[model samples]
Target chain A: MMTLDQDSIHKHSFNITNLEEIPGKKIKHHYGLVSGSVVRSRNIFADWAAGFKSIIGGELPMYTRLLNTTRNEAIQRMIAQAEFMGANAVTNIRFSTSDVAQGAAEIYVYGTAVFVE
Target chain B: MNGLVTAYLQNHELVVGSALLIVGYIVGTLFQRNHLRSIQEREAFFFKLPAVTMKLKSFVPESHWDQIESARMVVGSVVITPDYFRYFLSGIFDVLGGKVKSYESIVDRARREAILRMKESAPMADIIVNTRLQLDTMQPSIPNMPIRPLAVYAYGTAIRLKKSSFPQSSEEAIRFPDQDIIL
Candidate 1:
């Protein structure tokens, strides 16, 4: 399950903050914005079922699971990006979504990478 | 015999299509109502959680606020494809050039549910700061498909807050039906 060095980077070292600073850490190096993103769509069967469900109008659990998985995937890739950059923390983390095509969308995550002591 | 056969074929197609339309409408309505009810019940619990956004400059420091967090990012996202009835209604709205109100509530529910899930995943989060939501309305896979799914993502810095020294005593220790509401 763990992917070697990436696990170490993910476990405790990589702190995330939206504000300029964390509580009690001194930031050393600012490596600019690093990001991870992915685009995905449901399969033909799921789409067909979703279409049927749309008529009556309720929550599409299948689509919910799909989105949950895709968002996690994108965030993991973002963390991996920060790890590759030799950074210990990320601040000003942001998430954004946009349509790439019909039935397919992309989730993009970005944050400022920094080294902290 | 040929004319009879042709008439039968046309009739059969119409019967099947109409049956599906009616079925989709009836079932979709029930599902939508149940989903809304579920959201209302969940919201009564989730709203009590001390979740806020860092969008403005009014930044609440986790430590100063007595939050004891390990500095991690918590994320929650949801995708909702409209029911066939709403999809058809939206198509009509598109032609009429009006606001697609039918589709709005689903997105709102998805956004709230995503934040709820994020909070659930990170139970120790004092308050989810820098909270943001993204909505992506997918286009149809085919020229006129009924499956235009919209994905909503919610993410934030889920920091642990020292709950022992916070205000808002009225909103304390409200338990969720599914999970314990531990802030």
Candidate 2:
């Protein structure tokens, strides 16, 4: 079981933004696009609860949380990759999701790693 | 008396099915009404903060370029499931081969809610640019589930500008739904 330390993972010291350029900073080096992905599935209990909730037409909190955590983990991995490339910050970040299998959801995030000053 | 009992027993499934449908219709309608009302109220509140799909350079004038102080990524996501009543109606419509009106409203509501949430996350930002929305249908492991839950995810770069030149309400920023209905 992989523990999800979302808050701790986000504490990584790297400037991450989804803009063409970081504000008030100049891009000195472009390390190319860095990407990360995660595939996740919910347990039987959560699936059962969501099935019941769907009948009444409402928000499914369990699934929402599952996807949220998955996305955060994927972003963390992307940042780690950028850090490996000796980049100080990442720009133009984007996220995408796809259904890989019957029970699994894949979250993919990508961004350009750059040395900004 | 014996014939009457037999007849009731034979039609018990139909009676129960109709009862369930009636309950689902009433509850689903009430929930949709309340949710739409809440969305309307929040939309009015966030009207001042515009989130557009265009890039920052094109959307904001060149003069405002130097006014931008900082930018950050903001995201909003929601997962909504269709009611049993709608699900049942769509199933029949599937056989008839036509538009599934019930599902359309479900998708619309989720999209609007996701955008509203993105706006709520960045209350201090002057505007959000490069806005994008992703819609996905979650396929659960549960077997025999007729309707899959829909997830709407929205994200954008929220840019903060120097407050001195900030326009409280810009005409260009308010383009959504009915473009002419200005608040």
Model 1 misplacement above 4 A = A1-10, A101-104, B1-17, B55-68, B95-100, B140-143, B163-183
The 0-to-1 C-alpha lDDT of every candidate, in the order given, reads 0.65, 0.79
lDDT by residue (B1-183, candidate 2, tens digit) is 999878876898877767667777888888888989999998997787889998888865766666676676777788899888898899899899999988888899999988887776565567888999999999999887767999888888878787623454643344232221111
Each candidate: fraction of true contacts kept?
Answer: 0.57, 0.63
Clashes of 1: 15
Clash numbers, per candidate: 15, 0
Clashing pairs in 2: none
Question: Candidate 2: where is the Cα deviation over 4 Å?
Answer: A1-13, B1-16, B61-64, B164-183
Task: Score every model by TM-score.
Answer: 0.75, 0.84
Candidate 2 CAPRI classification by DockQ? acceptable
Write model 1 residue lDDT over B119-142, tens digit each, in one string: 665554556667777777766565
Per-candidate DockQ values are 0.40, 0.41
List TM-score (chain A only) for every prediction.
0.83, 0.90
